[model samples]
Structures are given as C-alpha cells and as structure tokens.
Target: MTAPEPYAGVTTHTPVRHHILSVLVENKAGVLARIAGLFARRGFNIYSLAVAPAEGHARFSRVTIVVDAESAPLEQIVGQLNKLVNVVDIKDLAPRDALERELLLATLPVDDGNRAAVLEVVANAAASIVDVNATSLSVVLAGTPHACDLLERALEGFSDVELQRTGRVALPRLTQTESL
Candidate 1:
C-alpha cells in the first residue's frame, strides 16, 4: 500500500499566470511554516503572502497567498495544499472577482524646503500623514494594490524615503443582489 500522489490527476495546458489563493487553516504554530515549506520543496515562488485571524475567530487563520503560477500549475499548488492536515478551506480568487487591498506605511525625510511639496504629493495620493516631526513625515495609505503601487512610485521622487507594505488581502466581491 502506497500513499497517493497529491497531483496525480491534475492537468493543465494553459499558459502559467499569477494566482491568489485564500487559505483557511487551523491557527496552529507550524501551519504557516508547513505551507511555506511545501512551496519551497516544490520550487514554487510565492509572490505575496498575508495571514491574519479569520473574522476575529481565534480558532482559524486566513492566509492569502499570491503564487507565481508561472513556477507551477495552479492545480498542483492547490492539490498539494489540500494535503495539509491543518488547511480547512481554499479559495482561488480571480482578480476581477475579488476586492483586494494592501496597507502601505512610508516615512520620508522632509524639511522647510519640501514640506509643502511632500504634503501635496501625499494628499494627491489620498494618503494621510500619520505622524510629523521637524525632519520627517510618516504617511499611511490603505488602498488597492494598484493605488499603492502608484503612490510608491510617486514617493520615489523624494530622497531617503522608507516604505513598508502589508501584502495584499482579498475577499470575493459580492454581487449587488447578494447579501453577506
């Protein structure tokens, strides 16, 4: 008797692409490591990953993984993930079918000469200045990934700007007639 191969029946002919997998798993210590190790052992690249408690529930955590599908077939990724004993559910969210957001926090050196300009840029990006000091400004923006990208690019015009971003987290978009 032998264990079955997880990807045994998975097949795909389409060109590889990016995939967003929302995984629900038991909130145990090694669950994340196991999932990451699985991808690493298979040589699959993870584009982005975000994990948090699911719906304020202490029993489970939600992991949003943006996988580089170019590295492996989506079916194979999902199949391997399903083999994890801690994983409770998985959702492959199509871009248009999902509402995704990322949080960006940036700190930029500012002074009397560029203070107005910096504030203007921040306002234009719809970002708020969360903190201000004599020499620097800390700004925050919680928006769509594209919006965050645009803001990040715009910030590159300044010097000594530091940025940190929370990987994207997404949920399926709800239709107008649907109720949650």
Candidate 2:
C-alpha cells in the first residue's frame, strides 16, 4: 500500500480529555523541580503549568497543572503527588466544575494603512490596546481559553505579529448562593 499520510492516525492515540490538578505546596526551593521531575521520569506530558503564591502567603504556593488523561490513570497521578513531602493538597478539578482563564498579549506591526483594520479585529475579540507606538500596537486580553485562542487566530492575519499566552490557571467553581 502507498505510504500512509503523515500522522493520519495521530488522533486515535491522542487523549480526548485533559486533567487539571490544583496542587498546594510549601513555597520552598526545589519543590517545583521535584514535581516536574516526577512527571518527566514517568513519561507523563504536562499540557500546561502555572505556579503562584497562594493567598498572599509566603509559605505556600499553588500550582495548576494540565495533564493528558490518557498518559496515566488519574488516581495514580494524585497518589504520586500526595507522596511528595512539599505537596500539601491536591484537587483534581473536572472541566465542568472549574473556572479557568488565560491571558493573551500580542504585539502587531501596524501602519497608517492597517491600523484601523487591526483595531477593529481587537475590538471584535474584546481585547484592549494596552500600548500604541508609531510602528506597533500591543494588545492584551484576559479571558477564557477559547476567547484567547480566537484572538490569537484573528491576529495571525497580520504580518509581523507576536503573541504570548499565559497557560491556564483555574480554581473550583463556587456554587450559586454560596458566599466566599
């Protein structure tokens, strides 16, 4: 038979869902490295990871990790994470139960000829122009992952555009009528 199309079967092997793990850990040196090393050694690919200090506390930090579910069983990942001495808590958030957001920043080369068009696209995407210079415009959008994706795709139409996205950071969704 003729050579199969490259990566034609890739989808068959790819995971259909991603797991979000919210891990609280001691804000100590090497804690992140240890966690990353564990995943690397186990061959589990991390889709995205974000870390930040928790509740303005110096002693604790929160790490949001997105993992491909098909890489390993969910329970196994949590169990291993629990064994880490620095890990204080772990919450495996289901997609429906979490509130997720990402930030997108893009710088686009603009001229008198295309400035209006570029601004129109930004407005349509609900992004704001944070900086404007003679030769370029810098835009920022903080929104859902899908919104960021759409804005990125729309910006690709302009030449010399540069884009960066913050990996997703998520928290459990609060129940309606529940006070924080």
lDDT of each: 0.85, 0.83
Any residue pairs clashing in model 1, and if so which? none
Candidate 1: tens digits of C-alpha lDDT, residues 36-105: 9999999888988999999988999999998888899889999999999999999998666778999999
Q: How close is candidate 1 to the true structure, as a TM-score?
A: 0.86
On lDDT, the candidate that comes out on top is 1
lDDT of 2 at 77: 86
Candidate 2 residue 82 Cα shift, in angstroms, is: 1.4
